[model samples]
Target: MSNENVAILMSTYNGEKYLEEQVKSIISQDYTDWHLYIRDDGSTDSTVNLIKKIARDNEKITFLNENKPKNLGVTGSFMDLLANTKAQYYMFSDQDDYWMEDKISATLRKMQASEIDHMPICVHSNLTVVDTNLHGDSLMNSSEEHWSDFKSMLFANCVTGCTMMINQELKNLLDFDKVKSNKLYVHDWWIALVAAAFGKVVYLDRSTILYRQHQGNVIGSNKKTTLFNKNEPFNGRVIRMVKITSDFWQAYGSKLTGQNKNYVKNYASLVQHRNPLWNLRIVLKYPPARATTTGNLVFGSIVVRDYQKLSRLG
Candidate 1:
């Protein structure tokens, strides 16, 4: 450990195309005191070779390629890399994306000062996406204006991975080992749901990177403008969401009790299938709208009548 202020947890799989460039951008950051825990998911290509070369060449870069015999896929590989970091703040990184110079600095500042607990997950920022060489807004930041923004976490995900930075408060609760067992989801949704359950999630209104969107992504960038593509229909979106929310409750059920569990189950339903329970939640609690310092509370308690409502799964 070099007494760094931040550690970047990066996972790669066949990322030779942009791996060198991404590494270059990180190494060029003005904030020099940081460690990068880079791991390859048993890539057969030159990707692993490049990582080895990088580890040999740079002191700040540390490689974690010892994840057993076979590749762990995306989620498992990332989790394996993440479990190896020990920094005051940890930020998730993808193989193809490059971070802005101030990315770590800005997120680390907030993490150190944040009053929230690890139970609520972590805080994240906005992203500016790049399509091929041209750039445009990912339009995720504008999600803050959604009608159901606060109440509709299940309906849509507003958080982006490149923009995430977790504090020690969150770090303590996040058993990186445990996430590998939760079969579904990329790391972003996992963090968002966990954080929102315990407390409010703060969104920094800054674009942290050039979120390169391409067809090669395991889960392509969730940019608003890209919705016109027919392959990216909304039917699968709702189903994938339902699965994600349901899995969250199932995996972390024991950690929650009391109204928190009730709220999570109810809220998850409200989000996954638009179960009328959300509106009912507002009625049962007898408060139309209540505000917490960071997140607002809508207490509607309508029992879910239909459990079989189906949607096209993503």
Candidate 2:
């Protein structure tokens, strides 16, 4: 693989503590044919200075939006990075996580094996969950029975951006300008939806990166479950899920296929209908395939019980 074929995009914001370590891990990757693009999202700390110093030493590392720090949030920063860079393959990087040596090579291999001519494809792997000190026994597996289904992806996203490598075809399909930052919940979820709906979402069941869990993490891994938290109130979880689904539908519903469009439309409209029975019927007809059976049951119950309240709030 040529250096120009692979681009790793990292968006940094107040990640001074772990940024250097993470960058070092990338620099030590077994796959050396890759370029690193770092964009600072208005950091108050020495993150920019650190990046500049490192870029000075390494020719492959390039700092983006230097000196001019626009505070595009996480999703916006990543979308901006994606929009600016062109490559045969693109990988997203988080400043806090450490990549395994073979992370790039393994993910690229899987992507190459799964590629189809002119079709958008995204390949992502599981992560080894680690604490701030990079110690952990658990794995953040990125697999669900129905994760590849468009309807399932609308309800829950199993893809993690830091572990993802998307091809040029998938990059072309992700139009950042079409969907505003607010409506798009997260960049990874939006990309997963696009891959599920239009092309292929290939999941590699192996761990590729050290997924660091810390206080400042925008999104963290949960050892118990990825879809829903058992401790949170059922209605609150259902409402949040509904809102995200509605946002996804509002953003890209029109671009989906006829069946998927109706599926998303019905799911997003659950809060609009106050009738519990109607909501129950909809849930029964088009159930979101959650990771676990308990999740599906809880989701169904909450949608039925809180339909009226959800409508009132909306």
Candidate 3:
């Protein structure tokens, strides 16, 4: 185990085009106490070769699974890195994004300030949405004031992985075995849920990175689903939400607070009831918190109208 205070975990797959630039950004960070761990997820391109070359010149960088690259997808690759690395603080990185020079120092400062003795803590920040050419657009932040709450996190995730930092206590609570069995939506959402339930979630209102948007991005800012889209049905998104929530409950429901446990239990039970009225009743009685009143209403209406379809999807 390296004595570095922070471990920067990055997973790349066919990211040869922008990988070098991202690595350079990490190397240029003002905080030099961090170590970079890069895992190539079975890339057929020259991404692996590029990483090897970069790691050779930089002692701070470590190429993980260098001999055996596996296609574990984004979530799996990140979890794999998390399971193997030991550090006081951990941050996830995307191969295509550009981190600000002060990204690590700023996030670490916030984490240290908020951390308690052996209690889980996660610190996340806003992102500056940018194009492939690094042109900045609007800042991306959570619209929901209570986004760190368990109920809000269960339904909608505003935490972006690239802008997140977690303390060692929070990292220790992450169970890779449960992660393998459950239908998790993403690694970031799971971390948020654990932090919200067992410890504290701190939000930094400032942008820490240039969140690059491009065609190859697995999940980009522009690709997010809006509450209202004429062509897209709301059922798909709601169904995914139910699946993720149910999986989360099954994985960690026992440790949740009494109120949160009931909230998740009732929400997860909606798919079990055959009658739309019954499902609607449950949804009405225990609605998940949303950013706005309109959003809450829309989400409830979708569950009521498409209960059968949502159930089937689940």
Candidate 4:
């Protein structure tokens, strides 16, 4: 591989158990022209010490914010990393996942083969779900390679940060300083939405990382069943969808193109409008924003005030 620089941005809290293994995987990559930039968010455990040990042995691994570490959550920590790091390509890493040896090289190759000059591009691949002990679990299916429509991106976020790689062009365009902590949910979802709107998103069919599923995960793999009661009536997903779209418009409305801005506005109205049935009306009038037919049907069930119907789709 060429000597082009790639930055691996990782956030660690009290991840003493799997942190060392995750860092080792990065060191074992086939492509060696990469720097690991890690930030510890007020970890009182041995996580910081482990990172320091690695840093002492390897010059490429830099521990960020050793003096006065801030207690930003996962999303905030990643946002800080994105703002400060400088690289030709960037990849996000979790404190627990074990990446395949060729993960970086494969993603970089796909990114390079795309038309770099025309638009910013992001490449993400499927992941193999694994248990806490790194035993092989199940394969995660890949979504469609491209999501050009802003409306579809608004309702669902299929992109996982651990499997994502982005060009510097897309990185430069994000206004990280202006990002409101309260409005944003996940850093990867925000990046995916922006990339889908202003750039290109490519999905490689192959699995690139072993996504470890444990009890402490902030967000679990899609294949994992929801921790909540299966028959629960209160629809948190609907509420979250409303908030995410609304927050995105509040944060990035001015940055979006006119067409994308309109799509955001239309989706926002479906959630925020005073009329309770406005969502159903929009679903009937506008083309379906969701990608899957089942997804559209489930969304329509929510719009038509049928929570039981939506739950049955599970």
What are the candidates' C-alpha RMSDs? 6.4, 2.7, 2.8, 4.8
Query: Roughly what TM-score does model 1 have, to 2 decimal places?
Result: 0.74
Best-to-worst order by lDDT is 2, 3, 4, 1
Candidate 2: C-alpha RMSD after superposition: 2.7
lDDT string for model 3 (115-142, tens) is: 7777799899888889899997668754
What is the per-residue lDDT of model 4 for residues 148-174, given as tens digits with 9 covering 90 to 100? 456666766667889999988888768
**Which prediction has more favorable TM-score, 3 or 4?**
3
1 or 2, which is superior by lDDT? 2
Residue 192 in model 4: lDDT: 83
Candidate 2 per-residue lDDT, tens place, 94-165, comes to 999999999999999888889878789988888898899999968866344325777677776778899999
Native-vs-model 4 lDDT?
A: 0.77
**Between candidates 1 and 3, which one is better according to lDDT?**
3
| Full candidate order by TM-score, most accurate first | 3, 2, 4, 1
Task: Write down the lDDT of every candidate, Cα atoms only.
Answer: 0.62, 0.82, 0.81, 0.77
| Alpha carbon deviation, residue 3, candidate 2 (Å) | 6.4
Clashes in each model (backbone N, CA, C under 3 Å)?
A: 14, 0, 0, 0
lDDT score for residue 177 of model 3: 75
Cα error, residue 210 of model 3, in Å, equals: 0.7
